[model samples]
Target: MTGDPLAPRAAPLHALPPLPPECPLPMPVQALGRGRIANPPRPTTPPNMAWRRFGVIGGVVLLTLVATYQMWWLLRGDGIDVLEGLLLVLFVALFAWIVQAFVGAIAGFVLLLQRRPLRMGMHADGPLPALSTSTALLVPIYNEDPARLMAGVQAMHESLDATGQLARFDVFVLSDSRRPEIQAAEAEAFVALRGRLGANARVHYRLRQDNHERKAGNIADWVRRWGGAWPQFLILDADSVMSGETLVRLAAAMERHEDVALIQTLPVIVNGNTLFARMQQFAGRVYGPVIAYGVAWWHGAESNYWGHNAMVRTRAFAGCAGLPELRGVKPFAGTVLSHDFVEAALMRRGGWALHMIPGLGGSYEEGPPSLTDMLVRDRRWCQGNLQHGAVLPARGLHWVSRWHLMIGIGHYFTAPMWAMLMIVGVSIPLLHAGFSWGHFSLEGFTPTAWWREQDGDRFIAVFVATMFMLLSPKLMGWLATVSDPAMRRGCGGALRVFVGMLLETLLAALMAPVTMWVQSRGVAEVLAGKDSGWEAQRRDDGVLPLRELVRLYGGLTLAGVVAAVAAWMVSPALLAWMSPVVLGLLLSIPIVALGASPAAGRWLRTRGIFLTPEECAPPPVLVRATELRSPGTNGN
Candidate 1:
């Protein structure tokens, strides 16, 4: 019936060769020897980008300084006791984090208001351009649900075929699944996907026996074996889906900008069926753009890369992004966990431009379905980001690259810092009550605000300013949303959008202490040399049994109760001051359970609450993926 099963079919399939067993390309592991890359190529940096960088950094520094001064004035009344000094240090560190985010969000708000199309010779809207070079869509999976994996692949392939760029691209399902049953299921899914797409489809699957370094290693194996065949490659997480138009645009952008090694797209979280997931989806949709745009605008050619939904120049990646095993024991040593950030940093160090286009739509991924799931994932990420402390010192990395690494590290560290701040805050009052140190006074602490009174007024002003900085970013996102007619309509009108924002904010406040505790625990574990081994993420409804929820969050509730009682015994004013943290900790279990509830999610959706554009009016690719993943449709 056939001369060779691996032979290409007539017409469409003939444009690209069948997957080869061995097409060797040298992908030497990059050396960390302390030196800059000799005569590295010059990347084309964005013009006037210095001003943008200065604006973001300057704004952050100025605001942080002002907040620091205010805190100092408020605490300087009694000559700054030991407890007060510790409190001030924590306050300043935490306030700096807040200020940095606020400044970035403000920049994003301005960028969104301008609505200027980002240029690197790539336009988000317009007729699609034809791609000249081949691109391999690399989907790396490990013990994941095969049906969901194949569903995304089929969706993207079908979408790409619609754009007539299918011939220029190939799909590779790279698996690191260790379970024999899961491995077999993956093969079956690949076969089923191929059958559905017909013989002309250029989809292939490979299951590696040795899953060295995990996902990063799987991609590298592909690069060494078959990377020479393609000029570009786009990495997709198991749940990633991108519209055909976006894929073509990314490839064409790479073609146009040869010096650019990577381009990261803003992936909107979709298909969240749990309340927790929905909250995450809504926040990401509403506030994500401004935050992303602000970073992208200022970052320019030195932007960071997320792990997936990004296109990369194969040669640049092979040459510059080769990762070496860190020489250490367990968690902080060996294979890089958060490879995307490190890869981008390395590529940029080699003088290749890395950019993120947050304005470019059509990229999507799903969120962890529950708070528990989120915490588990965050633990692994926490370790990975903390490991970046090692890479930060690598020679020749741009200051911005170092900043990105620090930001990643800080993302985890701040959790502990916030938790410590609350702890210190609670302890201060507890100590005063326990040791009989007498009542505190705010007599001479006046740093007069333009329209405030002396003592307590200064305290009120400082507190208000801190809260304002914390909440202003959300307000900016809400403003941006209401201003856009299409977005507003998609998010269930300006009223529902505002309602959704408020609900999300309230829920977040209640969840804040719980999150802080979990992250603090994660940081502590990683620091204590515990490794977060690879585990497949839960994709279905995340509702857990009441007992399970209790087991997970009981300690937090007990802590909250003790803190509340202690504060109450001390003074009612102290209790009031600590209520937010105490309340959140007290309700941790219910807050997490509510987040994991699919019933609650659906109930809210019925009322147009927590709506995102993807849910309201999905792109065709997402719509197709849903159809293919229906119970009877997928080959499973």
Candidate 2:
């Protein structure tokens, strides 16, 4: 068939339209022709990846072995009773977990020192190429406050519009809200947002009748329906916000690198008003980078995804990341709660690359306002992570992917293990005091003089070593910030940063026992077949009342007192060692109440304590985001 003379010539399949002035062509794009584009070669596994893996594993194993030996030496001939044996096993497991983290931190420090970009072959100095494909920006909402959600959406939309590349992207609010009132409010907000942006605005909203699998199913539905229209999609949480430049750069990077299936940007915590939130914000800004970079350095093409604040190729996601209903019932089976890691694993299992870029900036999210809020979230996460046991045996997963799943599972398990270790430690002395309780007693005990002679010093040494391993990552993070002049200044200089670190450490120590108990309870509950049902997170909740605090922690305080008295009866030295934990639990009510106080956070901010770079020198996008307010809506 002959074409009409007036017909416009069709654009070549590989050809991309001319980019705006802001979107500079990178080296990779410079090589592409109008009709033909060169696809970059797939990333190869680093030559030293095997050695790095071995080094991390060997380091953890060596430290564990040495620690175990010391522990054995300390406990030897103390009549190796059943309680003692259980204690040793728990201690070894906990020690190994901490050692693995220590090794990972050391590796991250070395990588940071090298000053290499986390994006393997991508250069840091070059300009990013313009995007050649359409992208959909998806914000999934549950029963969140419509005003807050719309505010974030409006800010992001405006930011993208300012980039002049807004035409290449569309915004969608995928609501899974169950409340009729919340749904009506969401609809009003969406309409207001669209009207404000004019008819040319690309923002759209959809509410699902049934949130089948929750967030995962919500996104899967989007993928099945509208996903085919776009080549890539960026996922955002209700509290998430990304700069226009960052979004465009992410798109450009995806365009340049065909082998990568997903890229997760490190989302810095911001907008914290409560003391608990401020502490988290400070830690995330100052120390989170080192840890993230370290993981990224070794993770390379197999890094895990964090659900939101990330970009994924729609085709790869649709084909590979369709999650299966887990084998059994509620808690351990059914729908996966923590779906990010598993989705990344499935993507990698299909031979697609998953990566993290810790160095990239302008991605932000909010933290839970109070400790109670955090625990509530943690309870759900704990159940989801425990469910990963079923996914661990899935065939065709990469070794690194399996390691990621195992690490996640191990995170929750550590809490219960630590709790068990403490119980055993306290009980050992009770057993020594000739207190025969049930099956555990010091009957017919054989004493090794050598072990008894050196036990105190050896025990002290093990204690010091464990403390070092636990604290080393924080130290490394502080060192990383101090090494950079700009970062140091942004964080209120060296002295202030050091003081802040000290305070943070003390507060963390005080909070550890409380978290331990809470997580342990969560694990127990999950194991008891009680599912953490999908509930809206309490993001903006205020400081809890003193009465409610007491009500929540009264049992814990009572247990702490009893335990303290029991330890004192055992010996003053044991009491001293257990004091930190006991005291923390005893003071749980006050600690939680004070920590959630916005006034206290403001006081700290005024004193230049726990101040983050983002707080000190706010980014323009962040400023804009904070300024955007949601319109009011009446309940249906």
In candidate 1 the C-alpha lDDT for residue 245 amounts to: 94
Clashing pairs in 1: none
Per-residue C-alpha lDDT of model 2 across residues 1-636, encoded as one tens digit per residue: 697989534333123222112211111101001112122335734557667778888899999999999998777764578888998999899999889878888877777767775464444334545667889899999999877787777778778888788889988899999987788778776776666777657787788898998999888878877776788899999999998878888887777767778989999999899989999888887778878887776787788999999989887788777787787766787887899998898778767788888887889999999889999899999999999998887777778888999988999989889888877776666556566545433333322222245476887788899999999999998998888887888888888888889999898889998999999999889989998988998776558777888888988899899977865654555667678899998899888988899999999999988888888899877887677742333211
lDDT of 1 by residue, 1-636 (tens): 759988533323222334657776788888765659433544557788879889889988888888788878866754879987998999988888988888889989998998887767678888999888999999999999888888888888888888888999988989999987787677766766777788667898887889998999999999999999999999999888999899999999999887889999999999999999999999999999989988888898899999899999999999988999987766899999999899998898888898898988999999999989998898999999999988988998889999999999999988888777766765654454343536533322211221143256666777798899899999999999989988999999999999999999999999999888889888888989998989999987788898988899999999999988866665566567678888999999988998999999999999999998899888999998898888878532
Candidate 2 steric clashes: 0
Task: Single out the weakest 10-residue window by summed lDDT for candidate 2.
Answer: 24-33
Question: With candidate 1 superimposed using the best TM-score fit, by how many Å does residue 305's alpha carbon deviate from the native?
Answer: 0.6
Give the Å error, residue 50, model 1. Answer: 1.6
In order, the Cα lDDT scores of the candidates are 0.85, 0.80
Which candidate has the highest TM-score of all?
1
**What is residue 127's positional error in candidate 2, in angstroms?**
4.2
TM value for model 2: 0.88
